[model samples]
Target: MNFRIISALVMRYLFLYSRSPMRLVELAFWPVVDLVVWGNVTVFIQKNTNPEFGSYVLFFLGGMILWDIMFRAQQGVAISFLEDVWTRNLLNIFVAPVRSSEYISATFIVGMLRILITAVVLSFISWFGYAFNVFQLSWWLIPFFLNLMLFGWSLGMISTALILRWGLAAESLAWAIPFFFQPVVAVFYRVEDMPAWSRPIAWCFPPTYIFEGMRDVMKSGTMNWDYLGYAAGLNILYLALAGWLFVWVLNLTRKRGLLTKFATQ
Candidate 1:
């Protein structure tokens, strides 16, 4: 966990983005599009529905923002690794003095920076475009956002591990894997709205509690720490599992001489 090595990796990613305009646009594009499309739909729903239904803008925008936190966090790590793979730089980084933990730490820091930028942009859009103040959610938003980021980072770790083990064939997992948890996360709906069988599975995801908690705040204007606690607990477990899996896969890659093989292909 040397800060110099970690900073070097972070600076490498920063330089990559700085040199590519498309990369910066791509980083902010999907999140803005998601907010615009869904923000308009939320306005439409609010116009037609009763007040008791709560703020559709908040509900929709909150979900989108939180979901993107996880998405950005996951991409921060997984895509950063994939960037190395695409440039055939993975072998070079690992062969250097970089430790596995340092690489991950750097990715996590980069992901946080990305998430912050995206979140700020989307939050302003939600406020001015939709007249929804996400910051109004107050202190509860802190843990909600952190929990989602942790879960996203965990998924990112697993995605990177799979890519390491399976080579380019597993690259799609970088983008597609997070979607697999969407339905189960109950992001846009309540946990009870899910099928009973799915409810059990949904509970396994940390975001389920966060979104449910968001809805609770919208309706009652009260925060539910219980949901946050449950989410935090689940995030810890998932993050630990992800870390172990990443290390195991990395060691296996070295033992099997897959790093060199992957670099060439």
Candidate 2:
């Protein structure tokens, strides 16, 4: 873990984004679009026509903004790895003094930065445009948010591991993997409200507890330490497994000479 190596890798990734305007716009574009559409839709439902939907305002917007945190964080790490593969630059980075651990650390740091920027942008829009302040969830939002990020990074790392092992053909998992868990995580709905069969599956995902805890806070105005603890526990477990899988796959790929295949193709 060389700080200098990590910093160099971070700047290299940042430089790629800086040089491409579309890449920069992409950071905010889809997220803003989601916010506007959902914000307006929820506002519509919260109007005088539907008095019962009043409580849902927080559930919808808050859920969305927080959900995006996980989505974007996952993309940050997974896509950053994909960028190198897309550019045929993986060999260049790995062939240098940068250890695999350093490369992974750099990706996580970059992911954290992207999520922070997007979080601020989405929070601003939710505040002025939708009158939804995410921080109103209180300091509890900190642990919940961090747990989502950890889960997201775990997913991202696993996705990256898949691509490393399967080559470019498996790249779609970088973007597709998160959505698999999306429905089961109960992002916009409650776990118990889901089909009885899905409850076992839903509870396995770390975000499920986070979102459920959020709903509990919204209704009761008190934090549920149990949910936070459960989410944190699950996240740590999954993150450790993700790291192991990535390192294992990297070794397997290297032994099979797939790294050169990735570099050439």
Candidate 3:
């Protein structure tokens, strides 16, 4: 409700990142590594073995861009409280006029902004460098991308609440959850090449649908409504679950006085 307070927090977060731009390089590591390793590997494989693999590489790259957006957004939500714990600024924030709900709202807005910025940067690079033709022409994916971003924000907030409860030990959860999508992404050559049982696990990640959709749109110029609906539905359900979990965790932490238990550390 207090847009001013939320906007202030969002601006502060962006300013901090602007001051220490090197930190972005640290955040950009995973996506760049993905682009380099898989980019060359896919080109090599397709040139020598199967040219079909070339499209797979492009699809995977797009998925990496989306995955990176999710990862960065999660980091924003999960680590927003870390500075307060690490540097003692959180005490001042709590003592300020802002309520917990306002703070939570600020975190969500910042996370979405972070994800959108990353998506734009990655999209520019992919389109020019590799001739990523899928999203270049199809602007319809914007709504789908926004939905995925909302789902990611909800999950990020839940992870942030866990971190607020257990401290830095919960940091691993942020990375671990996103890491599972790596092998399932299109960059991995062939999903069918993997074991039969693993195929189901790979399909479970929403980005798989995203990659498939991008490929279909690029190659066939037709949308895959079935896959899109399934992924969208699953994300909506997960977003609800994530919001519920975040609220529960936040209440528990407040009651237990665990939100600041590790602040002095």
Ordered by lDDT, highest first, the candidates read 1, 2, 3
lDDT value, residue 166 of candidate 2: 87
lDDT of 1 by residue, 133-228 (tens): 888778878888899899999999999999999999999999998999998998898889789999999988899999998878866779778888
lDDT of 1 at 100: 95
Candidate 1 residue pairs that clash: none
Q: Candidate 2 lDDT, tens digit per residue, 1-265? A: 8999999999998899889988878888988999999999888877855666676766988788888889888988899999998888888887888887898888888888889888999999989998888888898789878999999899999999999988889888898999898889999999988999999999898899999988888878786788888899999899999999999999998899888888779
Q: What lDDT is reached at residue 125 by model 2?
A: 93
Give Cα-based local distance difference scores for all models. 0.90, 0.88, 0.68
**Could you give candidate 3's per-residue lDDT for residues 171-265 as a string of tens digits?**
68765665655676443345666778787876775656666666666567777788777778777777777767877887787788875665555
- Against the true structure, what is every candidate's RMSD? 1.2, 1.2, 2.9
Between 1 and 2, whose lDDT is larger?
A: 1
Q: Which ten residues in a row have the lowest lDDT in candidate 1?
A: 51-60
Instruction: Report the C-alpha displacement of residue 27, candidate 3, in angstroms.
Output: 4.2
**TM-score of decoy 2:** 0.96
lDDT of 1 at 210: 92
